[model samples]
Target chain A: MEVLDNKITKFREGLAKTNLSFREESLKYAEDTLTELDFPTTRVERWKYTRVAKIANTQFSSRKDVVKQLNLPIQDAYTVVLVNGYFDKELSSKNLPEGVEISATSQSANNLLGKVATIKNEVFTALNTLYATDGVSLRIKAKTIVDKPIQLVHVITGENTIATVRNVLVSERFSEAEVVQVFLSENANASFTNNVSEIIVEEGAKLVLDKLQNESESNFHYSNECVQQASNSNFKINTITLNGGLVRNDLTIDVDGENCETHLNGAYILKGKQHVDNHTVVNHLKPNCHSNEMYKGVMDDQSTGVFNGRILVSKDSQKIEAYQSNGNVLLSDSASINSKPELEIYADNVKCSHGSTTGQLDDEAIYYLRTRGISEKSAKALMVTAFISDVTKRMDNDKVVEYVHNQLHDRFGWDF
Target chain B: MIKITNLHASINGKEILKGLDLEVKAGEVHAIMGPNGAGKSTLASILAGREDYEVTEGSVDFDGVDLLALNTEDRAREGLFLAFQYPVEIPGVSNVNFLRTALNEIREYRGQEQIPAKDFLAMVKEKSKLVELDAGLASRAVNEGFSGGEKKRNEIFQMAMLEPKLAILDETDSGLDIDALRIVSNGVNALKSDNNATIVITHYQRLLDYIVPDFVHVLHDGKIVKTGPKELALELEEKGYDWLK
Candidate 1:
C-alpha cells in the first residue's frame, strides 16, 4: 500500500510538470485508482506469463521536449498525430469521412461517452485521460461506410519519457470503417508508452482496426484494446508489432450478441534484446457467435516472445464456435518463445479449441530447397516467408499485405 | 560421364552401400533394378550429394569433376539432377518461381546471364506441354498438394527445364498410374541426347519397357549382382530375384 501511494505521488509529481489540460482531475483519478486497485503484477491471472510491473516501477516521466523530432512522410489518408500522449492539432489533419463525427468531450457527456469513462480504473488509461489535452472521439452514422482508412500516428521522441494516448471508436448500425493506428519512436534512448483504444461495433456493423507498432529498441510499450460486438456485427483486429524494447499488448473482445463474428490476428518480428508479449481474451456471452484468434511470432538473436490466448464460453452461449492458434519460430538458438492457449466453456454444446506450437525452421524443407540449387540462406528465407505467408494472406487488402511482405523482407535483409 | 569406384556410404551410422562400383558414359542409359533395401536409393543419393548419406570410402567423378566434394546446390548447378521417389512439397513457392530460381542460379553458377522472362516462360510452356502438365499446376506452389502422378510428371518437367548432364530418376515409376508413367517416361526419353546420360533406378521391370536402357544392372545387397542388355530386364521379370538368390 505504501509503495502504491508513493508511486502515485511520484506519478502526480511527474504529471504536474506537463502543462496540459485536465491535470488536476487526471491526477486525482490516478491517485484514486492506484490506492483502490492493485497494480497488475506477474501473479495476476491474465498477466501471469508477462512481467509488466517491473516496467511501471521505473519512474518514467512525460516527455515534454520529445514531440519535435517526428518527421513522417505526409500520406493521403486522414492523418491524426498524438505526441507524447497529447493530441497535436498543428501536426494533425482535419480531413474526415462523411457522416463521421469527432469531438473532445468530458466523462459526463452521454451514455456513449460514459462507456469511455470506465477507463479511469486503469492506471495508464487514467493517466491518458488526465494528461490528454484532447482525445479523438470517432462516431460513424448509421448505414455509412468510410472508404479511406483513418490513420492515427503516435510518435515518441524523448529519452526516459512516458506517454499515454486514448482512442474511442463507435460504429453505428449497418456502418463499416477501418482504423489504422501506427506507433513510432524516432529516438533510440529509453522511453515508455502506454496506449488504450476502445471500439464498439453496433448491430449489423463491421469494423476493422489495424495496429502497427514500430517503436525504437529502447522503449517500453503497453497497450490495452477492448472491443464490444453487437448482433450480426463483424469486428476484426490485426496487430503488427515489428520492433520494441519491451512490448505488451492486451486485447479483449466481448461478443454481447448472437451471430457476431470476431477475428483477432497479429504478427510480430523481433530481434536483439527485445521482448514482446501478446495476451488476448474472447468472451462469448451469447449463442451462435464465432471467434478466431491467430498470432505468429518470429524471433532472432536474444529476443523473447510471449503469447497467451483464452476463450471463455458462457453457460447460455450454446452452439458457439471458437478457435485459437499461436505459432512461433525461433530463428536463433538464443531466441526464446513462451506460448499458452486455453479454453473455458460452461456450455457442453459449444465447440471451442485452442493450440500453440513453437518450432525452428524445417530442416527437410531447407534441404529440399537447397537440392534445387537455392543457397542455404535463400532457402531459409523462403521457408520463413512460407511460414508467415498464411497470416499475410489473411489480410484482405492487397496493398497492406504487400507492405507487410516488404517489411518482413527488409527485416531479413532479403529482396522479395 | 559419371564414375563411382569402391563407393561405400552410410546413413545414421548404418552402412547402406558397400563398395559399389558403377560407370556411365555420355549417350548411355543405365537401369539399376533391385529388391527392397538394396541400397539403390543410397547410391542415387550419394551421387546427388545428399549430405545425410556420408560417403565413408568412395570417389564419384561427374564430367571429370569431384562430385563428392561439391555442395548439394553446387552439384545441382553442375548439371546433376535427382528425381526423388517422394518429391518434397514447398508451400507458397510457386512452381514457376522455383523453376526460374533454380534455372537462373545454375546459369549464374556457369557464368551465364539469367534467362529472359519471355524466354523462360516460353520454355516453361513448351516443357509443361511435353510433360502433359496443366498450365494451372505450373503456377501453383512447388509440388504442393499435387497428386502422386502430377508430382512425378512435375519432376520430369523440372528435369526438362534444368537439362541436367546426368539425370538420376530414383523409383520414378512408383505411385504413378499407367498413363502418368507413359507421360513421364516420354518426357524423360524426349530429354535424352548424345551429350548427357541417365541413371534409372527401379524395383519393377515394367518401367524399363517405356524407357529402354542400353545397360541393365541388377543391384543386390549394395552391389551390382548382374549386368546384361535390355533383354535382361525381361528375363528378370519372367524369373523373379529368387533365381538370383
Candidate 2:
C-alpha cells in the first residue's frame, strides 16, 4: 500500500495544476479509478512486449515555459500550440474560418467528455482524465468544408517533466476537416507524455488525422484515441513514429453506423534501445461497413516493435468487410517484433482477413544490385525505403510526406 | 582486355573450374561452348565476383589490374559487366532509377561529373530502343513480371546503357525465342566497338550465329581444350561436346 501511494504521489506530484476548470463528476470518477488500478506489466496481453516500470518509477514535475517561434512543417496551417500541456494563446493562430471553433478542452463544458474513452479498466485513460493540464477542443460545424488543414503542435521541454493532456474533436453533419498532430521535444530527459483524445464523426462527415511522433530519445509517450462514427461517415488516420524511447498507442474506433469507411495506417522506424507498441481495435456495430488497416515497421540495433490489431463484428452486422496486415523488417539480429492479429465475428456473412510477416532484406536482391554498381549500403537503403513507402504513401499529404523523409534522414541516416 | 591463368574454383568443397585458361583482347567476341557441368556459368560468376565460389588457385587480370582483388561493385565500376543466366526479379526497384544510380556511382569512381537528368533520360530512350524494350517497362520494377524473352532483352538493354569495356553474356539465349535472340544479338553487335570486348557463354551455338565470334573455345572438363576460328562452333554443334572431351 505504501509503495503504491508513493508511486502515485511521484507520478502526480505537480500535475493538474492548471487553473482551468473541468467537469466535477468526471474528475471524481477518474480519481477513484486511479486508486483501484496500478501500472500495467509485460504479463498483460495488450502490453506483452512493452514494459512501463521506468515511467512509473520516475519522479516528474510539471513544466511550462515560453518559446519565441516554432519551425512548423506546414506554414499555412491553422496552428495550435500546446507547451507542456498548456495552451499558448500568443503562439496559436487567432484567425479562424467560418463555422470552425477552437478552444481549450478544460473550459469547454460538453456532455461528450467521458462518452467515447472508457476508464473502467484502462489506467492511462484514467490518469489522463484526472491530471490533464490543458488541450484543444476543435469543433467543425455542420456542412463546413475547411480548406486549410488544422495543425496541433505539442511541445515538451525541461528535464523529468510529465505532461498529461486531453483533446476532444467533433465533426458535425456533412463537414470535412484534416488535423495534423505533431509531438516534439527539446532538452527533455526522462520526460513522460500521457494523452487521450475523444472524437466523433457525424453523418456524412469526413475527417483525417495525421499524427507524427518525433520526441527525444529519453522521453516516454502514451496516447489513447477513441473514436465513434455515425452513418455515411469517413475516418482515416496516419500515425508515423520516428523517434521515442518508449511509446505505446491505443486506437479504438467504433463503427456505430452503416456505410462508413475507416482506414488505419501506421509506420515506425526505430533504432537504438527504442520501443514502440501499437494496439488498434475496430468494432462493426451496423451493417455494410468497411475497414482496412496496414502497419509497417523497420527496426534496427536493439529496438523493439509490437502490433496488436483486433476486429470485432457484432451480431446482426452483416455484409461487413475488414482486412488487416502488419509487416516488419528487422535490420539487426538484436532487433525484434511481436505481432498479434485477432478477429472476433459474431455475425454471419462477413469477410475478414488478417496476416503478419517479418523478415530480413533479400540477399539475392542485394547481390543483383551490387552487380549494377550500387554499393551494398545504398542498396539496402533503397529497399528499406520501398518497404516503408507502402504505408507512408497513404499519408496523401505532400508536406507531411516530405517531413517524414526529412526526419528519417536526420535521425536514422537513411537518405532516399 | 582480360586474362585467366590456371583458374581453379570450387563451391561447398567440390571443385567446379579446374585449371581454366583463357585470354581475350579488345574488339573481339569469344564464344565459350561446353556441355553442362563443365563450368561455363562458373567462369562468368567468378569474373563478376560472386562470393559463393572459393578460388582455390587462380589469377584474373583485367586491363593490367588484379580482377580477383576487387569487390563485386568495385569490379563493376572498373568496366566489367555480366548478364546473369537467370536475371533476378527485384520488386519495388524501378529499372531506370537503379540504372541512373549505377551510372552516377560509376562516374563518381572515374572522377567524372554527374550525368544531367536530361542526358540520362535521353540515353535511356536511345539504349532501350536498341533492344526494342518498351519505354513503359523502364519505369516499372526491375525484371518483375517480365516475360522470359523480355527479360533477356532487358539484360541487353542494361548492357548497352552501361557500355562496359568487357561484357559477359551468360546463357543470355537460354530462354529467349528466335525473335528475342535476334534482337538481343543485334543490340550486342551494335554496341561492339574497338575499345570493348565480349565473352559469349552458351551451351548451343545458336547465339554465336548472329554475334559471330572471332574465336570459339570448346571447354571440356573445366578447361578450354580447343581454340579455333568461328567455324569451330558449327563443328561442336554437329559432333557434340563428347568428341572434345
Error of 2 at A349 (Å): 1.8
Q: Taking the tens digit of each residue's C-alpha lDDT, what string does model 1 give over B1-245?
A: 99989988889999888888899999999999988998998887777777888888979888889999899899999988999999988877788877887888888999999999999999999999999999999999888999999999999999999999999999999998899999999999999999999999999999999999999999888788899999999998988777776
The two-chain DockQ for each candidate, comma-separated, is: 0.58, 0.76
Q: Return the lDDT, model 2, position A190.
A: 87
> What digit string (tens of lDDT, one per residue) describes model 1 on residues A1-416?
22344555555555533233343555576557866755566555555656665565677776544355453322556677877776777767776778887654233132343253354346555655555433456788999988777777888877777776666788999998877788888763678787777778999999888788888888889888878899999999888887788998988888999999998899888899889999888989999999988898889999999898889999999999999999899999999988988789999898788888899987877777777787888787776676677677776655556666666676676545
Candidate 2 ranges with C-alpha deviation above 4 Å: A1-6, A17-25
Q: In DockQ, how does model 2 score against the reference complex?
A: 0.76
Question: Quality of candidate 2's docking, in CAPRI categories?
Answer: medium
Q: What is the lDDT of residue A389 in candidate 2?
A: 85
Best by lDDT: 2
Model 2: per-residue Cα lDDT over A289-374, one tens digit each: 99999999999999999999999999999999999999999999999999999999999999999999999998898998898888
Record all residue pairs in model 1 with backbone atoms less than 3 Å apart, i.e. clashing.
Answer: none
Task: Categorize the docking of model 1.
Answer: medium
Each candidate: RMSD: 3.4, 2.1
